[model samples]
Target chain A: MQKQKIIFISLFVLVIAYFGGSYLYKNWYTQNLDFMAKENTSVFIRPHSPIYGDANAKNYIIDFFDPACETCKAFHPFVESIMKKHPGKFKLVLRYAPFHTDSYYVVQMLEAAKFQGKYDETLNVLFKYQNRWASHHSPNISLIWAFLPEAGLDVEKLRDDMKKPEIDAIIKQDITDGKTLGVTKTPQFFVNGKPLIKFGYKELQELIESEL
Target chain B: MPPLQKTSNLAWNILFLCWLTATIATLGSLFFSEVMMFPPCIMCWYQRICMYPLVIIFFVALFPLDTKVVKYAQPFVFIGLFFAIYQNLLYYKILPESAQPCSQGVSCTSDYINWFGFLTIQMLSLIAFSIILILLLFFKRKAI
Candidate 1:
């Protein structure tokens, strides 16, 4: 009985410590966000960026993202959920960083699709099929075109628009701005023009919620 | 007096807790990768190589109350700890991306789930290994 009691207490302590550590870390997360938000920047969101959710929403999330980034692919669903949860409370302005070798082509494709009012559909398809064509090490860039049909995009028109100087300029301006802002990574987010001090889903959500 | 015996009891209990922790870590890692579909990077695989063996070895030792389990398990636990520390360094950008072994597959530093802005998969593995090492060391000293 004593041995059983000792074992029970031991397990209980470990469980408590796990939860305690998580709780304490959450408090620290919030404090760090508060510190990071002290100096909000005007250049976080650009006028030409693609907007998701309610464009009129008071709280904005300016996200610098690379379509080829695996982490960005994973985070896409979570980011969509924020807009779902808050309705018109928040919106996201997406800035293309195009960090990977083939990511520039994908961003160009996205801009071309946007011209035909297929931005959301193309974005969804790209993210869904990211693993196939967006690989950082050995990206099969040609394979991305095969998935466009599923997203209801006109292949010939998309190809034509992809070569447009305007599309190139959009990609270039976003990349320049991202560099100026010291964004060395994909899926870098700023909530209400205040950069996230750390990268975490909970941290991003909490920061956006606080702004809302 | 009773204090010495109490210490012995605590150490023994901690050994049991170590087993429990390893069991959870093993299962939790599987759940994340298999069920949750969070792909494991190369470092994660290395850590798994170290941790997976521990679950079986620890379970075998638990039934017989074998203190010799610690002697056999220490190397694997230590290796797992090493990988976890290396992973944390990569995740924090303290180590350069060029040094990452995951050049072909998933990026080693990718954030799968940063729970509470701190607990990544690597951090969780580090915590598990640390507890197991400390508990085993304590029990070894107590001659459990």
Candidate 2:
């Protein structure tokens, strides 16, 4: 009986050690966001403004997003609401990091609309119709064109820009930038060039408010 | 001679099952990505690292290799188990209150692929660990 009890105790200790060690390793490796921030080597819009960070603002929030990502789509409205509430206090730049092939076209289309100063409107429409057009199969280009009028851009100019090299370059640069920053997923944000430790709208808002 | 033959057969059976399960899970995940169009998160990549090796390891174990190979593999499986358990804990949110276990993407806890609400990468790891433990125990018993 005593030997059996000892065996049970040994097994229990091993189980505990296995679980405890695993937990520690996961937390330690995953929570280190500083490592990613250091790896960012993408070209910036200006000094200290990598794609999404504010160029001239003291407090900038940079969101690295993929146009076709479901998570990015889910997180868009919350970010939009924050931007609406704090316009000048927070400058928002949308950097395109295309994870899927479909996202590349979406980014290109959005950039094309920028030529007509309808970038923000086009972005909102893209986020809204992301699910519709983001697929491994061919997306409905007609639906994309339908939103051009709503975004206050001429359809012809938008179509022309979609096929432009400049738009492709812009999208490619964002991907290049994302790789440098160690951003592996969509909807990743940085506050004042520091990657936010916690995710969620409330956490992001708190970080922004604290910075201000 | 009879006992040795039985032991060899048991070992082969265990290795075959492990290989089959690992292969099915991996191929299924890839198919899901292609068909369902869900992008693999960072945690999924780590799980892949732990699982992919089993395909080769198990195949080798099924052959008549040195006892040293089995000894070497025993530790590797344990290491994989550790990572899998760590991943599962992060997924279940049992690690720490402020554990940001997954940088810049869908967290390990997100459960992008949860079969029957419990079959997760962690659960798979638990199964793998149990298999290794059982094999180790069997070997020790045989030695005795």
Candidate 3:
């Protein structure tokens, strides 16, 4: 009889915990969701921001990344996969957050590529060669220029474009925007103008899925 | 009452506590991932694999006050303890980031929640597992 009573009590406690935990987590989710969304204002998206997918797509995922960040480089493929998985349901908006000093140069190069319609290609090449050019402590920023030729980019034009004031302005504006949005790290994702309460690829995908 | 009966009663109490902690820990993990939408990393998944079964195991053992339940459940607690400790090491940066099994998306070193600057999801898991482990050890010592 005592054993049965203990078992009953144990089961009762477990049920209470399960329900109570769900309640507490739901409360945490909504509170943090609102706090996070407040910082992911539309101001984060500029008129000339680099983007992928249909412009008219109803859902947008804005990625704040640093070209030199290892985590950003690692997460790029997962982000791409998420977009591919959803098709026309989602669009990706790329914003540069040059957290590292060298990242500004890489962002400038990408912005310059926008003029030649090679923005996406250049961005891919940069990610591919990131280890060589974006490595910490001994980065070879010049190595990035070498890969441009193979991507069929006009090397001289890119160099000239990289020096343009407009490219500098774009990078500067993105930094200002990122700072306003409370982004202090690379690969920060905001889904449909809502910041991820937790940073993770699955979390980002699930958030997008929920919005969908 | 005989001393043996008294010790047996105390052992049952400790076992009950162990069961209770495991139940709460498992539910808490689910709540964070499902309701709160927090992504769990590879190490977190490993820890979950070790934790989730104890709820059923302990509940079965509880109905009969099976003393031998300790033999079955201790392995789970030990394995779970190993993972929880590893996760804490990674969380504290004592283990290098490159050593993390989370090669693809969510970083194992990522901090989802850090209460009071030191407490984290991994720390919570460690504490939970430690309590169950200590309770189980107490049960074994009493040999009820």
Candidate 4:
């Protein structure tokens, strides 16, 4: 009887300890991913990257996003809402990773929008009408052109700007940097240069609140 | 085995059902997390803490037909049920987003396997906990 009791107690404790330890380890490792600049930290931000929120904010959230990626669009407003809540405490810096099929053109249009100071508006328009234009099979780049009017840009000027070689180079730099930083998918976020290893909506808020 | 026959057959069956529920629930969770590669959220961990211990306790108690397993094992059942209910509510969106407890998208905020577009892993857990709780109560009332 005594031996059986001891065995049961041992088994119970062992099960709890093993799983509990694993859970704690995962959370601890992800939340403390501030080892900072495992690769070139310089690749995190570029001069061409669009900066949202206060330019002088100390907490820099470097986002690697795709125009056509569904989650990137869904979480855009959520990320914006978080930054809005904190007000000047954080800056959301955008880097383009045109991972989807034909997303390169949408990215080009966004970069070109920078020339007319309509980058943010153009991005909003693209995301708003993403379902109409973006698809994994073959994105309708022409449909995106129709929506550019919503962002109130000069169609001719935007067209001339989109063909610029510098914009293409900027996109290429972002893709290269994204690979270095281990951005395997769209909507990847880094808080204050620390990667968000957990990659959940709740986790995103937690990371931002922690930095704040 | 003679000692087991000394009790009512219904009690033995109820106890056996409880053990079976616990065992299946434990293995089911492992299958989801390990085999299916679905990540459990923080709420699942809390419920796991309650359920895992009962497997051992019930297993030990059954071999000797010890009725006192209820005193200790019942607590775990109740705790597991609580968390299971909370998780189901969050997963089904019955609870508000503000009440969400899982983080890193591994938990409540992210979608899990939605079998037939309705059932989910959390719902499976809820059913397991409920069955065990009902069997335990039945055993206590009629068998004990």
Q: For model 2, how does the per-residue alpha-carbon lDDT over A31-150 read when each residue is reduced to its tens digit?
A: 444454345423323232223323455565678887667777787777667766766566666677776646577777777777787777887787676667665434555567766577
Docking class of 1: incorrect
DockQ of each: 0.12, 0.05, 0.31, 0.04
Residue-level lDDT tens digits of model 1 in A71-180 = 88888889889889999988888999886777789889999998788999998998898888855545577998899998899999999999999989888889887765
Fnat value of model 3: 0.67
> Which runs of model 1 end up more than 4 angstroms from their true locations?
A1-42, B1-144
lDDT-based ranking, best first? 3, 4, 1, 2
True contacts kept of 2: 0.00
lDDT (tens digit, per residue) of candidate 1 on B7-80: 65565666677778887797678766654446688888999999888877876676546778888999999999
Candidate 4: misplaced stretches above 4 Å? A1-40, A135-138, B1-144
Which ranges of candidate 3 are over 4 A from the true structure?
A: A1-28, A31-113, A117-212, B1-5, B93-105
What are the root-mean-square deviations of the candidates from the true structure over C-alphas?
8.8, 13.6, 8.2, 12.8
Rank candidates, DockQ, best first: 3, 1, 2, 4
Model 2, residue B4: displacement in angstroms?
15
Higher-scoring candidate on DockQ, 1 or 4: 1
What lDDT tens digits, residue by residue, belong to model 3 across residues B1-144? Answer: 459778777877787788788888988888777765567888889889989999889878866678999889988889989999988888888988788777765677777789999888889899999999988888887865
Per-residue C-alpha lDDT of model 4 across residues A76-193, encoded as one tens digit per residue: 9999999999998999999987777788988999999999999889999998988888765357898888898889999999999999999989999999988666576778898887
- How close is candidate 2 at the interface, in terms of C-alpha RMSD after superposing the true interface residues? 11.4
Q: What TM-score does chain B of candidate 3 reach?
A: 0.94
